[model samples]
Target: MKNENRRTFVKKAGIGIVASLSLSDIPAVMTGSVPDRPEKQEVFFTTGFKAAEVTTDSVILWTRLCGQEKPNPVVHRRREAIFRHPIDFDEEMPVGSMDGGVKGIGGSVKVQLSGGGQILESEWHSADTENDFTVRIPFDRLKPATSYRVTWTAKLPGSDALHTAAGTFRTAPQFSSPDAVRLVTSTCQYFWSYDHDERGFRIYDSMRRLNPDFFVHTGDYVYYDKPGPLGTTIEKARHQWHAMDGWPSLVDFYKGVPVYMTKDDHDLLRDDVHPFSPAYGQLTFGDGLKLWRENAPIAGKPYRTFRWGRHLQIWLMEGREYRSSNQDKDSASKTIWGEEQKKWLLETVAGSDATFRLLFSPTPVVGPDRDRKTDNHANKAFETEGNWLREYLSAQENMFVVNGDRHWQYVSVDKKTGLTEFGSGPVSDAHAQGWDQEDVRPEHKFLRVKGGFLEIAVVPSDRSAAVIKFIHRDVDGNPVHEEAFSSS
Candidate 1:
């Protein structure tokens, strides 16, 4: 892949320009560069692939197979048997280490979860053939909040095209406590630019340094459908997942951090394709969503809640998928969070006994401008949750909202309520555009469209009161903004 452009971007775009970083600055030590390698030989059916879309209790592992085109045009096919072997964290074996398993490749491939031993193997989907010849296995029912070792194998029909890939992931903790939860929050990755840069790597390394209990990728992991010609894919009208593979820097960074990822518009396919756009903003293909499922470490349930001891419980909502009415925005009934998710979030919040409740979103609930309101595709979790806060829990102060999408970082506290919102933009990929400070209400606390991450400390007190302090900083660890407050 051509990386000179990325190399140049990094050298020039330092400090906060998230998209400016180039691929050259990464240390050879960090990247583990290939030493004088020849062109890759073609391996059809199971040669091209990497593990992705990880979650706590479950994972949607995927891979691309190269073989005969779909609709084989023949009946009475000779199918091969395929099987998976799962091991506990104590098993330090590789995918190749496992022995005794079946295999086969039919354009698309997969296996579901059942009792401990591998048993759920169904006919693969035909539609999965066209895009990179990939298939997904949504492995649910695994132990929650625990680590697992997975091994996948596919044996070609009448040929030794045995294909396999191995990886590890920890299920979102099933149990929560004040002290066991460690979530690392960050956003705006701009993968391709980091295909060669180290800035993104540096931040991820720091996150690993903190050794967060779990990693939370707030949003914009990959800018879907980048506006220019350099990005967008014609066949799909959006962007492609292979773009992620090209980003060596990002892949390298994630290799170290066990990331639980979600997206704004970027990971979905494009920047912002609303109801008014041409052809429903390029229509999100199952293949694209499938790719995301393959890569990120998250639970399969689009929106689920996890308890972090008695001190905290986080309810992750699928804010974007069903935010608006299934129709274009013209309908009077259109909304950000559909009635179902909204109801669930409200009920979950009202019933929770945790000391702190957090709604982790991809976009800001209260922005100074009209960015999300216009994008039909933008998630409505924030707006919907904000409304719930106003109508249902007027004085609720234990809940905290955090989001990352814009290429900046800031904190704001509502005067009428103790609710505070912390916004962190492109972790390393700073953007040129910024939030209009003047547009914000006079009560807004801090706003800066700079690239950085937020460090939050929740300290418990004897009198049912808790102290929370947040410090926002740039990639180099310079504090740009800070705040502290007490909540009861």
Candidate 2:
């Protein structure tokens, strides 16, 4: 038989068969300097490479594997098996699952202190095809108010060559500590193509200079609606994610700083999509939700809270899941946050002792949406719940709402409740559509329609009070507007 046929037979037969084969049975090519077998090339990471869910002592590292060609058949078969028998998190249905045809790569992660001391090294962890060849490495028992560097090396199947990536993150400060908390927030990043614009995502470069503890991507991180119909299948959605990750700017940004992300209507399927929205082509809300969870650094549900020292408490709300249809009747019973999340929000607010409480919403809770009647809290669709929330927030001191979805930036206070709300403008200048200029509102303090981000600084003051400074910076990191308030 030819050398190719012999090698194929050898691969199919067990290693025992290979040992039993005679030298004569093996073709002459096997004995030559150039082996008859072809070597599998190493696969590298397409994107991801981010840190999330960072706490005083723990942070989750995320990454995805990619290759030049389709994955090996073995990888697809194994991934299908995992899909059939999905694993749940704490008895909840699996929020994410990998589809077939994605390669699974084995890897190890090494974490070290910023100054170069090794802290933790993980054993071999497979970036299994089951999770779309994505891996989350959790580093625990870390010190508070500390920075760590994480590095990963991945080995391709049947190959000795390795691929690698590295990132850094700083853990949250200890509870009630006097350490200042710095955070940056932005939304509406609609980069359909990497080279669509000339600047090529320069905003991220500016953001890296600011060196905030973490970034809050309120929503529209990926625009699934534009450029075409939303992806319906796992593979398609995963492809979109890989394409977005291919961007050099995003890759560099996530590698340096951790991010907290939430999804909006565009990221899901269409504008104002709910659980019951009519399917576009084969795409459904459930598919979008799965893709969002799978690609994000989060493990289960997106709604969660983060506390930084005693000065800052962040409530990241899930405005999409469990929301009523936008076409639903605008009655008192109509809901956006649903009952469970609303209850949790109220209870969490009532019990929190932090000096500054920030409610991060995917959509503006205090907005008119450029005179459009939409499903946001400012619209009549959710007036009843909106009023209740405004009233509840009115009674609470040192509370603010920071929102995305609207491309423009503005700081507005609730007319009745006096609750202040800050809007983080779009990250892409091209997506800064509608509201060419900030509209004059009864509570409007600052308005800028240009693309920029919002930065919040919480610093200790004399006595028991803390000063919170809100500054909006242009895409190049120059401060365009600023607002300040005191919290006691």
Candidate 3:
């Protein structure tokens, strides 16, 4: 099972959502919301709710007040997919309004928290048209490692339509506590390659079943450059987020699980984008940044770390905002992580006393990637800084890397430094590619050119050691590969 055959099985059977998870499997979770009929009937999108950036005592809750129930249906034409893109298009494409567009409405929302002994409530928060009809209410100073349920009600300005939804999440444990943590990580999601027309991506349903403590989306959540109609304008870019995040699979999974999100090339503007990168049509880099902040729950510094007890600490790296151009000469000064963030990473790694440290980067740091790739630390594009980072990481006693940009899943140990990395692969089978299944490298312990995700579990084995296990699961939630490491 620890090979490419597992994917071949998925392709043969679970190619359709009806075969994997039938629509009847989902109970209508949102109260007072109309059920989506089999006619592919138009139901009002509650836009649901998601938990993000959970800390020991705080979590940010986010939701959008959409004017419509869901994104406008996509327009697909079979004859005009001329570009090397995922979706088909017509010669005379409509670009004025958006294709899969769902606009934010002017409204206010009320939220209540009931988990600990004390029930907390909030005053009505305005979600105006200026902020994209989104509202974020933060609850702080709660108990650590505790489960909390959040209930919110959204009301449009004059309409009696009140949308009520509830979701639950657990905060991280205290740094010194001996708590075990389980989480799933995935990346590289393309809109047109959705396995189910209604569910969006089948993998979301799979990951939801694991019932992890949290989820990490390494990046490429939306393709600002790829088609489903290209996202060349700010309106189109905003359309990409709602269209992808508004899916039933995604909307439902985020209901119970909190998530940590990172941005990669596609998340920003286009492929290989840096600070000096040009605009994608009328969408400038700054505009992209603003839109991301509006949609995402993370507000402060983009790069940060979180600890899930004495056993595990994870550093999530930011690769886009402050990197030298990919075309720059490879030198010590060239960097994928800017000097400030790199310094912070080094200091945090050295100061942490956790049993295991996991570095999650949006791009690969120890990759056996294709030679043509130039945007990651594993490429010749930034080899000098990459080598320094690798050597430094190798010096750590119990450290591992989990990265997301690559389409294929693999586990590779750096031959020169003995550092190990796990690539989480793409979000679906149709979206997986970019590597040859037969061309396994000498450094690879496992390699699969198919879509899946990586799940890691941290458990206390004794007072002083912990067991960290990595399971690579296919889209149907079947484990294809498993690897384990023990604290030194």
Candidate 4:
């Protein structure tokens, strides 16, 4: 058994719908109304284990340990190391256990235990005292598309026996050029209504039917609604998230999609909230940063890229959050993709051989966020002005940009090169907003502010060209827009 004293593993961090025309185009509200969801009664952490961060070969597993309480609220405040683990498993394994044996498998601090092929050595580390009792383990050397069982235990101070739970997980398929792959991309799905069932969700349900390879969440997954009786300050925004239960309905939708997400203003704090937002220069930065990390799977580096087969490579950027000064409109020093991220993005794209290079920017990589009614830095610099990416786009013919934030969707073509930019937004907000719909230059191909997820079906062909069809849908699962683009 591992040392029960050194159990706290401290670090942390952390949808859509459709619609269409005709009978199916009718909104969910007007359709044969679905019954309201049942009220959530007691949530006593009845669920013991959860897992995430699944890769082709490895996954990060996590679970919680509870303390004594009719409700166990004390466990939520103290971050301590009162955890344990077994070295073996029995036939009747519980739902959330990782360790195998009942007692110390060997020594108190020095022991070897095996489960999923690799042996885990007991490393005494302090666990967080004030939070959910949890531990993260890297299941290494796991085979692709195979399932494995794991268990864990946490021995309370002075207790001889250990508390345990067990669960199983399967790794993603191997990555030697998949025979087939598809992706769905969109953003701005704010969630607070606990209904779990909604018109917005029907879109996600439909997308799942297509069974995409992997989904990309451009940003604005959670909207911290504000401007209430509470004071209008940055701290207020930070507190708003904790008050709103942090993660929203969008989070639940992604749980089933194996999604990759970036952050937008809503997820950060409010509409147009930036690093220099009133509270950012103060102490609220740490709290805000901590909360964002705790609730989302934002890349530590913020902007990163991933490749799929030889046809597509995705580059995602953190448009906001990290910045020194925003008032200096022309200051190149005022960063968007922070220095490191910018270099990595350029180098990755420059060296990539994929047929289509996709960049997922939270805000529009082309126009102003009309919803915010301001010249959002993301649009002005990253798209219109001479930013690093604006230049990079000119040199690559097969590259395209996808974004979310303005609560609208548009397919714009570069007047000069005929390059297209697609954008989606506010996947679940109450009302649809209008973009400069009338300002459709010959360069503008499509734009709509309807609520829905962008359905991206990517078909790889043996004949060099890959066909990607972009289908737009609304709340009731109706397809409203369809356009196809291909690259060789």
Candidate 5:
């Protein structure tokens, strides 16, 4: 029940740095303060400049043609001093210009991949008014366990000169190799509530230092329903995506490490929008789906599993796409993961022989979530399937869940089923809320209601099959708690 130093530190050195430094070095605010992170130069790309859906031999390279050089801010006239909520835009809020929001310019881009003595360049692809000047190029048949740099050169409609931007990533090792890997997972970021104004969210800086092989966004990439103007239309929704992704910290982080992006309710539309749920103002559930797909550099379906070498097998779940209505009766027929997705999950997990298997869910699975919340597998609204999922997963060897949506950090072990879940709290300390520190439940093994992220590392063991470590850190990259499980 006590906090432990990072397991790697104890293994490598007799004594290691605790939280990097003392609290005296940090400035105090009403909620606390963002510590000084090691300075990483921000790489500027005006519009869609990130790589995602990374795999062994393929990656989705995404970019958009923005008219401006930097990310445009969301101009607001009111102060949200208390709770964060969604609201429509004012008449003065410019919806079509870069000064108020990102405006797309039709252009053509050529992408090139370089690394390990191999360089391949693609033909120029034109962006048009139809798709908002965003383009996605999927590169495949790549070499495994190799580093690659992707560079894109863009030519504006009338401009003769071409502008260029680049990003770096490493492919996953062969599935059968016993190679260790590390990844970071985070969620629940509000654009209006970023911790550092210039740096955006400090968690991105903290995560960049770890140099994880990959990043998993469990969802809520942007709040379509939360303020800086509620995303009630395509224009406002695009503004939400641009303003969030436009942050220097976020853009810089994605430029270095590739990510696996998933969608939850907030980013999807309003809270818990299902097949039958009503729209948020004029924004339909279908529009929400298109917005996510438009912004993300995704390939194939949202829910899929990936293997890192021989030891780690990670499953990224899609909660919203194929789900039953929340108002439905909690019977066998009423399901969170529709039949097809449920079948895929069971079949894939049972078929995989990896030493450690983890599922990245946008919402809690084995949670002590707030009683009033009933949107995820952890709630009583879905208790029938929740119990079944817990029992089924608990019986599997070296199985665990990492979830998002909750604004607090926690580690919970289901007493009856023995299944465990880790909650990666909000992306900023300012975004943390929901449960009280004194409201510790029976299932909670460790609880901290603050903004931060969870780090998962699969380190190969000499005596065991593999050792999976979950380390929780504050916004400043200081380890608050750590746990390790050695697989046989």
Candidate 6:
């Protein structure tokens, strides 16, 4: 059979079989040597395979099982649990864990060291029903600054057929190591059925060629409110995620390198969403958060920090959660990071010893908003808190901000404080609605309203100062602009 026909046959034959399969039956199914089979046949993997939350000693591997007959019962139970206990509104419990009976699609994960050829095979790790058959397999006790290959296998529940996926990733160097770290950052990916151009996601191919240590997806990973044939519900959200995962370029990019993701307004709901805002059409904040958590391989608290060698320390902040209502007045009480997260941010910056502290903001922190909206930290609505943060950062030795959400790319510097910020352009060529190149601020060192990504190279130095180079590359991997800064 042809490739597409074979995939169709395997998908049709594999429906509703993931739950009944045993781990022991996967090896034969993978090798196409199942006992009593007339001819060799292989199982096909689902579209949802990627890696995330990589660290010096660990990395999270993920994949989803496709061709399910119906939604998993655990998903319904988890939805019911969210409805019963709306944790997003509850201040006491900022986050909640989903747990229930064992409704898992059995699978196995194998990790291999690239150079040493040491193979670490894991026992079956279930694709949980609550997570839409998505499984996250973590590889721990790994060496720092090393490369590894990860492979996942699963058998069709009733049949002796298996599906497989493979990916690669490199861990961060130790905190004291002087190794350099390369990172790519971008955001604002809006996929609509009407927009069928293949070039929309071609940037991933260029990103893979650069071979960055990791990619930081600032937000808009998916537009939950965009009109699609998929119905409005949590299931629709899962379908959207699966659709994005199925893209060939995206799959290839993730397989080459790991990603660090943060959620933005579009990814959560409609644009400019606030904490207490009403639901966007039929999707509630609770369901949106649940779907976001279920799809990604996040390990701990969403807002956390990562230390890359002795030169770079990255702070990934949560912009949506704990934010005050958009209708609130601009005061000290009107917060974005909430009290606890704000405290942590200040403490982490004060205590950090790295050469450069890079803060990742989902939205721009310094701006000339085309619209007079205060949803982002740049607006006057956050003046009080923003001023405090600016003063604190200015007092520090070496600090910078990297932001997304704006469809245009620009490098802006605060005139008074001398703090620099880099904005990663949109993933698609489309500009933000009601905004254009004319709206870019006067302080912008560079601005472009096209599709591109930011590549930052952190080079450690024998002296106290470290050199950081920012190369802005277009979709085809050509450097359109470049800038360098030193951190002491």
Question: Model 6 clash pairs?
Answer: 17-157, 21-157
Taking the tens digit of each residue's C-alpha lDDT, what string does model 6 give over 26-93? 66866577678454333344454666787888777777765532222212111122112212322222
| TM-score, predicted candidate 4 vs. hidden true structure | 0.65
Q: Which stretches of candidate 1 lie over 4 Å from their true place?
A: 1-131, 138-145, 149-168, 172-176, 191-201, 227-239, 269-271, 280-301, 325-334, 370-394, 436-441, 455-469, 476-488
Tens-place lDDT per residue, model 2, 1-488, is: 99999998888785677579997777677667455575555567656488998888888877777653332211111112211211231212121222212333444333333423546776666766667677776777888888787777777656567667777888898876867888899887654322223234767878888888999999887765553213544555555566556566777788878888888887787778888887755677777876777678886667888888878889999988888888888887788899899888888888888898999999888774655666789888788888888888778889899998887788888877888899988885555657747356667888777788889998888435799999988788899888898874
Cα lDDT computed for each candidate against the true fold: 0.50, 0.73, 0.84, 0.51, 0.82, 0.71
RMSD of each: 18.5, 10.6, 15.0, 20.4, 18.4, 12.6
In candidate 2, what residue range of length 10 has the lowest lDDT sum? 74-83
Q: What lDDT does candidate 6 reach at residue 23?
A: 62
Candidate 4 shows a clash count of 44
Ordered list by lDDT, greatest first? 3, 5, 2, 6, 4, 1
Model 1: lDDT equals: 0.50
By summed lDDT, which 10 consecutive residues of candidate 4 come out lowest? Answer: 98-107
Flag regions of model 2 displaced more than 4 Å: 1-40, 68-118, 193-199, 228-233
Off by over 4 Å in 3: 1-45, 74-100, 158-161
Model 6 deviation from the true structure expressed as Cα RMSD, one decimal place: 12.6
The worst-scoring run of ten residues by lDDT in candidate 5 lies at 39-48
Q: What TM-score would every model get versus the actual structure?
A: 0.62, 0.81, 0.87, 0.65, 0.87, 0.80
**How many clashing residue pairs, candidate 5?**
2
Query: lDDT value for candidate 5?
Result: 0.82
Cα shift from native, residue 107, model 5 (Å): 0.3
